[model samples]
Target: MASGSIKKEANGTWMFVVDIKDETGKRKQKRRRGFKSRKEAQAELTKLLNDVNDGTYIEPVKTTLGEYMLTWLDSKHDNMSRLTIDSYRSYIKNHVAPSIGHVALSKLSPLDIQKLVTDLRSKKDHKGRSLSASTIQRIFNIVVTSLNNAKKMQLIKENVAKLIDKPKIKKKKIEVWDVDEIRVFLDGMYDNRHYICFHLALLTGMRQGEILGLSWKNIDYEKKLIHVTQTLSHDRKEINHGAKSHAGVRSISINEKDVAELKRHAHRIEEEKEKAGEELYEDRGLVVCTNIGRPVFADTIGKMFRKYYRKFNVTPIRFHDLRHTHASLLLKQGVHPKIVSERLGHSSVTITLDTYSHLLPNMQEEAASGLGNLIFSDPQKNEL
Candidate 1:
């Protein structure tokens, strides 16, 4: 049996004190304060007693949101990528922890989360600019995920974060280079040292990490195929085995011209190795590396890319925009979306269509015109 009592407090509020026994049969008093009315306190007491009677009671603890989030992050370290984990930690330490970190995890409310989202929208980073909608949305997602986990662990009766609306994010227009622009850039950069890196990005739509992680063993010279098997981490400190997703592990076919370029690049590597000597040179069998066989940093590549595009007087776009340019060009050429999706290592064709939906209107018009020409053209007239 369970027993409890509710009474008015000296501060003109209501409090409840429940008599309960621990797992070891030791008697204890569970006290909760700050209810607005006696009825409210009574209702809470009734619920607590019912929970205990049904063996569903969870002992209350004073764990703060800050403390619990750190614990949650630590638990996820093994399952998440280092880049992802670092991003989450940055959000927690910089935005989340400083604001509502002192609040009790059990006491966190939907209103609190909503206010947090509102504040984040107005908040500025160290650069003194307002947080981007995407960034706010990410932080909101982290809070929702953390609270959901808390509910699963029985630390909270319900996930309060879910009761609130998620932050709305505005989609940014995708930037890509046109065919003429690509040709101009490539022709100018053809003799450059890092030309092959830019060439592979535009040709195969391989990610920067995938390009940097490419090994000699993954390339099939006779078949003219490149197999994506691994990626370098963003920090350039670790080589993470496997692709970003299951679909990311795929083979991309290359033309004979591409094979020739790669072979030329391989010869360049051999010349450098010979100059450095076997004792001084470290051979990790990487397709793209520094003179001493060290992995080239992603930032270094981005800087070089920016420098070349500027020197070529081409309209500026990020290195990643090169991958986008490849997909855009292929889609514009009437290649099926499924093929584009597979080549880009997207998880699904739907993602490919959604990403390039802006291009669909033109494609639709072209298809209609092509259909009309096919059905209405006179074969006899054409032969005459």
Candidate 2:
């Protein structure tokens, strides 16, 4: 029986080979080269035998980490969104491929992964800026997922990243405005051009894209509802893409006051259209658009809000925070979390709860007190 052998190759490297039966009962030889010495070759052979006995031996493939990562990204291109694919491409190019791309996929170890993360954390640019712990963790997670996919494809026998510890990330505190502050801001901009935009965002808790993507057809004047079917892409594309998820496609009831304002805005748009004529009116039919009816850019809206922000002299909060403020105010008033989740187009009530759980303790106490008052108002009921 042919067991194993170690010999010097013509290129001054030691090569080891082991004769074994594969899963199909066919005789095969597992050969590995590139060992610098006979001792290393013998030690590898011994370990190979142990692995074969333990039923964990896998034939290693000669593929570098960079090659596998590129292949992996190509494989996932169709499954991921445009923005997501772009982000993954950037992460791989900037962080992963530059570091451990030379290592063999099967030979990559937990130590190598740990060292890569440490290096990433310690590195600083000329401006003395290092990667944030969260960013480092995100890069590490991408590698972990890529390796996990490789394992699933049987490209590697094990995922080394799974054995490595993830970097710790500090969660930033969520800032929101109270109703009084919101009132001050809205009142300050009562006659401003983008007043309706701020009104819908604070009232409905819709995302910036959703608000910007709204069309006249999406609104139901009779039922007082706004259908959220799609949102604007980050690049300010006009055509609406489907909302983030199925849960994101929802209909939120609009208050009559906001509905009347929307009607007035629509009439104003129509007047502007008649004056400008069909030539000047681009006619994308967006609820919020430019003077000639082209889709409004998100940055433009943000800049407008910032200008009014200084005028209002209220607490400084990003326009996105208006959505959070809406959710927070509703949760404090004891609105059902499911309702809040639906209005905000969150994927689940759990997300809503987790995001606003800071306010839950007070709500819980109020709920308990109300229940006690309802059930224990009578002395006999209290005793029972």
Candidate 3:
């Protein structure tokens, strides 16, 4: 887009004109929009200049956030999964559209966004359930993102959503089981039939869905590596190959004992497969599966985890916390941040450090040791 001017007529009408390139990469192009006042026309001129400079300018449009989001979703639906499309749709219907759907795209502001989040938390659903902090944050991100695109497209002057104060979420303390506690948990798990699920959880730190959703094809017993290709969702749906973050896509090293146990389980499965008559197994070759060899439901895995907790006589924790335990353990052991980041499938080492900085012992040790030397050394004593 190129710059132009706001022309004022003798009749006291304001006219704004923007010169821009057309569909072809040629110089032949033009645009015309109007306002009731010279101030409005001047503001539009400034917006066009800034947009062209920022490389995010799109022509102004008379669309609402609700209307534009629906259009964007409709256009981009094919690029997303069934679950993701459904989720975005729900976000629009429930959060974005309901609150600020009537607000003009150009007029939405940061304060407005902050108020929306506050109201979401205080508002009660039909079931009397208040929105959680995390859920509100997710919705805020979506709404902001939609407005951000609107700004880039030149539909809005700016993304005031970016300027809004995002809600704060306190990170929960991760509970990691000590060796003795782990032993008790394992022993209690053996009494329950879902011991295999518990074994994979603590031993590998793989997610519940990853374990329940594991297929034989993703397992490389020869290499002793577990390839995480898909995750089992909390809703019992299997989403193929998408992880919570890029860092979540990882292959983990298993212990020899785990390898031996898996071998036994494999043989048992083989026997069952042979006895069940030839090809009942889809040959998809899942490492863990249900009776007919399809992926197990995520709820079933959670139930199994809870059962083992009761049997173990220990503090009950959510299954996802196991992954946190694994990362926390590695951090405590002074493992490099880069390695942990890769193992966890975090996008970068920065994320790993930010998330687990409290658990990291090496930096604390260095800082402590350095401070002691600086404070108590002979040179410092003499100087003081």
lDDT of 2 by residue, 101-199 (tens): 788998899988987897798877569999888879988898989999989888888899989788888866678887788889889887776688999
- Off by more than 4 A, model 3: 1-60, 191-193, 275-283, 360-384
lDDT of 1 by residue, 302-378 (tens): 99999988998887898988988899999988888999999999999999899887955687788899999889999
**TM-score against native, each model:** 0.91, 0.85, 0.77
Tell me the lDDT of model 3 at 381. 66
Q: What C-alpha lDDT values do all the predictions have? A: 0.90, 0.85, 0.73
Candidate 2 residue runs with Cα over 4 Å from true position: 1-15, 20-28, 33-57, 124-128, 238-240, 371-384
For candidate 2, list the clashing residue pairs, or say none: none
Question: Each candidate: RMSD to true structure?
Answer: 2.6, 3.8, 6.0
Residue 303 accuracy (lDDT) in model 1:
92
Give per-residue lDDT, candidate 3, residue 348.
87
Query: Candidate 3 overall Cα lDDT vs. reference?
Result: 0.73
